[model samples]
Target: MELRLEKFTKRFGDTTVIKDMDLTVGSGEMIALLGPSGCGKSTTLFAVCGIHKMNGGTLHFGDRDVTTVPAQERSVGVVFQNYALYPHMTVEQNIGFPLKIQKLGKAAIRKEVERLSELVQIGELLDRRPAQLSGGQQQRVALARAMIRKPDVLLLDEPLANLDAKLRLEMRSEIRRIQRETGITAILVTHDQVEAMSMCDRIALMKDGKIVQLDTPEQMYSNPRSQFVAGFLGNPPISFLPATAGAEVVLANGQSIARPRDLQASGDLILGIRPEHFGPQHGEGLQGEVIFVEPQGREELIDVRLDGGGDIRSILSAGAPIRQGDRVNWGVATDSILAFAPNGVRV
Candidate 1:
């Protein structure tokens, strides 16, 4: 189903939590609602599930306006981080509980439970209780329960947050596979950019209760609309250098660099560069003093203090013999340079 939210608004007393939020999830397309805590990403998810009444705006599932629909009638399945399940109930009972509430016959419920159990690869553990299962297994059970009713939309609230690194990686692939096979419209709420980048067809990066950048992972990373989006999405985070642009672009260190056309307006702007964008200056570039070098298995992070500017971090191949206290010249890839206005908007 195509889920749409138009001018959706939410609040607590006089405080507005969501402000004219609008988002669209195409039929069978999975999107990730990604942002840090208190950014209203999860609140938007709650609104979709009908747990929070919108103080304004409208909600729709396909052509059906479900703005006023009750939670139970929304046909939305939610999987929480803690894997909410009855500890006393066996896997079979837990998976079939929803069907039982709907008053399906015993035989039909049993068959449906079996199908869901196998679908989630928990068939062999049908008789086991929640206590007997590992975290990953328990998560599988929760997923089965959510899908048993074949909901129109699946909402996952940081579902893998509790798992360890290995398990989280495994579940990321698993969830993507399940969503693709089931062809269900899905929305995942997570603060982890990697999770959103890897799993979703598109990412809705939210900030302060509004969608800031809604685009494919590629576009969001390579062409961020604002400084916040650029800094928030990268793993190592982007580095910023104070710069002045006019007839000649100059860094705080008094180093003159090629001026980007977008900054031709000539004023003070911030030059944003990712660590990986810096490389050994084989030709001409900026000169800095190496403060330290940290080895990261396959790569090395070289921290340099520009002659007259702030700290500059560069990611280089681990094999490079660069060491601390070494003077080195590094140049940035022109294509990788991101210039941002003083107001935080990308120039």
Candidate 2:
């Protein structure tokens, strides 16, 4: 099912949580709602899934206006981080519970339960109780249960949050595979930018109940529409420095030309640079003193201190040589700088 939110707004007494939020998921597309805490990503998901009532605007699934539909009647399946399973129910029972509610025959429910278990790689554990399964196993069971009903819309609210880092990666790939195989429209809500970027077809960046930007993973990373989006949706995050229009924006050890368009008419603008945009500065880049070097498995994060008291950080190949307080030169071109307004809006 294609879920659509048109001017959807929600309020809690004096607090307006989601304001004029609009989003659409094409059939079989997996869309992720990504943002920092209190950004209203989950609230928007809940409203679309019929779990939370909105104070204003309309919600729909394809042609049907389902803003007023009860959650149970919405044909939406929600998989939460906690697994939300019945402790006493066996795996088969848990997966078939929804079908049981619809008064389906036992044989049909069993068939669906088996199919789901195999799909999630939990077929052998169908006889076990929730307590007997490992974290990853329990997560698979929860996913299977949600899919047994063949729900038109699937809402996953940080479903991988409880797992360890390794397990999160494993399940991340698994979820993407399953979503592709099943071809079900899905909405994933997560605070982890990596998770959202790795899984979803597109991302909706939420901030204080509003969508700051919505785009594909490549676009979100390459050309974030705002400072908040840039800062919130990166692994090392984006580095920000106060810069104004000039012939050469001077740095600690080096300098580069300001984007002519950026310098045309600007106030207090920020020069945003991504960590991976620069490697080793040959000659025409910022000059700085290396302060710290963190070796992260495959790469090194080189931290440099600018003469103007600002810090610049970038990723280097793990094999690169570096010492504490070593002066280094690197390149930062006009295109690498993202200029943002003081209001956090991208200019």
Candidate 3:
């Protein structure tokens, strides 16, 4: 079922936690709420689960208005940061606990429990207690438990945060697969950009409890709507160069100045260049002194001080003869630069 939040507002006393937040999750789509701590990503998730009361808003599940729905009646399943599994209960009993509350028959509960355990690949660990299971195995049990209820909407609140880095990487794809296979609309709240970009169909980038951008991973990276979004996405991040208006951008390297056609009149704009876009000089290129060269097995990361005294970086191939104090010619594609305003907003 699709979920919609319209004009959502939440506040504690005078401070607004979420402000006029609006979003939509299509049927079977996984939308991730990504932001740093205190950005209200978790608060928004809690509001969706009815754990936090909204100051004002309307929530709809499909065509039904579930604005005032209670947590249980909302038919939302939640998996928290810490796997909230019962310690004393065996995997079977823990998974069947929800069914017991629903008053299903014993045999039927057993069947449902086994089905979910198999689905999460924990079928063999049904009889084992939570204590005997490893962290990853225990999380699988928790996932199975959440699935047993067959909720209309599934919410994962940083479910992989507790795991080791390697395990976190492994579980993210697994969760995405399960969400797709079950055709359940899912919402994930996380601060890890990689996690959100890798698992979400679309990510809502939030700041101060407000969504600044909502887009696919590629769109967010290649066509960022805001400077914050551009700086927030990608590994190594996007580069910013101090620029001036002199009919066009004048790099101190003696290269001719030319403004992009779209930004001919944009005065004193900062230039955004991705590190990977720098290539060997075709003719006269930006002159820079290589300050440091990091040799990766596949590629080398070269840091250079531009002739204009600004720092710039480049990604070069391995064995590119890049060393400390080596003079290099860096050529940036004409179409690769993005111009941003001084207020950190993309122009």
Question: Which candidate tops TM-score?
Answer: 1
Candidate 3's error at 46, in angstroms? 0.5
Cα lDDT of model 2 by residue, 18-81, tens digit:
8888899999999999988888988887887777898999988889899899998888888988
Model 2 worst lDDT run, 10 consecutive residues: 251-260
The TM-score obtained by model 2 is 0.95
TM-score of each: 0.97, 0.95, 0.93
In model 2, where do residues sit more than 4 Å from their true spots?
Answer: 250-267
What lDDT tens digits, residue by residue, belong to model 1 across residues 263-316?
545688888889988767434588988998889899888889989768878888
Query: lDDT of candidate 3 vs native?
Result: 0.85
Model 1, residue 340: distance off in Å is: 0.6
In terms of lDDT, the best-performing candidate is: 1
Clash number by candidate, in order? 1, 3, 0
Model 1, runs deviating above 4 Å: 261-264, 281-283
CA-lDDT, candidates in order: 0.90, 0.84, 0.85
At residue 270, give the lDDT of candidate 3: 71
Q: Give the CA lDDT, 0 to 100, for residue 110 in model 2.
A: 90
Q: What is the Å distance of residue 83 in model 3 from its true position?
A: 1.4
